[model samples]
Target: MDGKKKNLTTSWGAPVGDNQNSMTAGARGPVLIQDVHLLEKLAHFNRERVPERVVHAKGAGAHGYFEVTNDLTQYTKADFLSEVGKTTPMFIRFSTVAGELGSADTVRDPRGFAVKFYTEEGNYDLVGNNTPVFFIRDAIKFPDFIHTQKRHPKTHLKNPNAVWDFWSLSPESLHQVTILMSDRGIPATFRHMHGFGSHTFKWVNEDGDAVWVKYHFKTEQGVKNLTEEVATKIAGENPDYHTEDLFNAIGNGDHPEWTLYVQIMPIEHAETYRFDPFDVTKVWSQKDYPLIELGKMVLNKNPENYFAEVEQATFSPGSFVPGIEASPDKMLQGRLFAYSDAHRYRVGANHNALPINRPRNEANTYQRDGQMRFDGNSGDSVYYEPNSQSGPTESHQNKQTGFPVSGVAENIPYDHNDHYTQPGDLYRLMSDDERERLVNNVVGAMKPVESDEIKLRQIKHFYKADPDYGERVAKGLSLPVPQNV
Candidate 1:
């Protein structure tokens, strides 16, 4: 027994011997208040779990490197893309948006493909999803839309009526709904799917030229998805299948990789474009703006501690480097505030100070002193602005060219409503079998709806997209087919 240094201490560093038993009276009475160790452990244990994220709660992450494959310094001044073959360390998190933290990994929902590049400039988080377009375009409807996707509070079960009722009312969601009902809705694995920065972001150059851009992470493994039948079987057999697959794949030296691509829209073209550039519900035509290869990402390392590295990590769209800036996309604009706010609420005010979220580059912000100030209050520096003695100041060299904005500042929806064109094009492009499955998926979900009116109205929207689509779903549901009604 090498008991030379066998002792334990409380948080205050006082050595204690009887940690196995609480200090109590007569070995049967309530524990003494002087048992600070017991008190501390119990209190901390009670608050061990923080609030789970409202969406994208079920996920996995890995450490990796993003190496530039091609130089695109002419388009944007983001340092990560400045030089070819330059490798920057990054952390990526892949998640299912609709499921709770303990939910099955094979659920039919969009997977979040978010990455944080730890570059010299700072941490730049590209918050994206596996799908190119989202259900809602405006940030104001985000909470409401998310509520419909979640389980019904009273029944504690998934409600298709709640889902379709909201989706049917909001026509902008039609495009995404089509994709969700298709084969891509349930990805075969995290490696076999594409990730998209669905919102258009403004990228500025050193010369102050601005262009709108969307990020695409095309999986080098190729896109593969499971049929509904297979997905259901896998879900019941292994609810944590995806998470286990990702961890074991990385651990077994088989790294998953993705190629980074960007589609840029010139500032001039955005003004004259047929649809609003900021509408997230619709995607820009790939034929018009081709993808420009930028880099490659490879996840090579799994975290030693899941909760510390993965669960504690926070990614916000607002976190941008010098050349990258937020656009006027309403959903993106709302996420700028909502993400950080949620993190703070869940992980305390200094959530960024966590090792996972902290930037590798030095941060000299005026923000200081909150809960979990692990970095020792920045060693007694000035927390206020306008200091004379080399306290970090704003940069004019990294200024972004701002476009002029005019109009009454009020809540307004985007003027464009051409939702059918894209969905129709998508429906037409699908193979016959794929289309049949999509219709079956839609009807299978829609059939259990208690309200006939919602079903009819939604079928009408589908009918507007393509008569075949509407008729197929109608037939599956045994609803009267609309013969040009």
Candidate 2:
């Protein structure tokens, strides 16, 4: 060997005697077990891929800081929203809910708008979607609802018959179904659409008084959507158009931004409210609960590495700081556990330690090692709580006040199942040209169902929303217009 030293080595840095051939009795013979280098290489490669997210598998993410422009300390004790000009580092992931990891970005689907804030207290994740409402109120039908969105088991392809069949059976899906079939279903770009924390959340003040709230992140770039023709053309031309646009925009110093706003309702209001406050399928009318300006979110920086940052980043609705807490929304309640479970499976139990998911400040918790213990294993500290020794302790100042829930702990039915009124209102709100486009879009999507039964069933739900809306769609599709349903 030269003085500089020259030698072949294995992945573990062990000196390898021979790399060109495996340990075998004869040339081109079967490999031997002693070929540990080969075994290690193949084994690691085999397990390299983690589980893909069941929803929002295709996404792009970035790192930025949320600067508090207004003082909301009286409304929320969340450290990030404490003082004027105070800034907290945040990570945001934009995604499509109904597509696989390799799916096209311009497809007709709701985009996921998830954010994780690294605060002095801990990481607070605001997990929401681009739309203000969901298809169903209760969480029990989530799996079934998603099944209809995905490919059929038998044909292994997206079946409109299956989709329409499911939607017709569940009248509660009319509102979201209408939205999905409209022009807004396919966003022109990620930067042009708004985001919402669809579930009703609770906000506790420093005085331990609470109010029901919902988040709305209005795009500062303005609300713009692609027409069905435009979206379809773009999808075919470039599957990753949205992802490329975001990354390139940030790269060129053109950061996309959104104005943060919230709609607050008093705790007492929910008790005597006309509609169920916690229903994810419904929205609080602006006439009722007006919006309050919070701050702004500007995506000024792109991720350093897609796999290290974007792919590994996780956000859970359960991850709340001092002021934020959950509401009685059944969908939100289910997500409190499900989101973290998804992260654990996709990343690992110690996913919080990952740079993208980890907090800026030191994390103190009783939870210990699992897979991938990268820390000094807590450095011989006491794992159990309530110890005399100085370990981590809970802050009484950060405790949230719980609201009263007085229903029997059984399979209670959803109180607000009237789903047509809002969709009807939405239809009537559209301009004449927009209404024609919406109807045409609905008819175009429904016409290819290849099943008259499924077509009529879905059309009936449209009739329930508005007779004019149903007649226009039925006329376009050449289907029998239901006189009355």
Candidate No. with top lDDT: 1
lDDT of 2 by residue, 400-422 (tens): 67655586778888866787899
Tens-place lDDT per residue, model 1, 1-485, is 87797568877788877878989887696778988889998998998778888899999999999999998888789888789999999999999998899999998999999899999999999999999999999889998999998889999898988999998899889999999999999999998999999999998887888889999999999899999899999999999989999999999999999999999999889788888889998888889899999999999999999899989999999999989999989999999999999999988899988999988888888888888898988787877889876899989897666779999989777888987878888999999999999999998899889998999888888888888888888889888777664
C-alpha lDDT of all candidate models, in order: 0.91, 0.87
| Runs off by more than 4 Å, candidate 2 | 1-11, 15-32
State every prediction's TM-score relative to the real structure: 0.96, 0.94
Worst 10 residues of 1 by lDDT: 476-485
Whole-model lDDT for model 2 versus the true structure? Answer: 0.87
Each prediction's number of clashing residue pairs? 0, 0
The C-alpha local distance difference test score for the whole of candidate 1 amounts to: 0.91
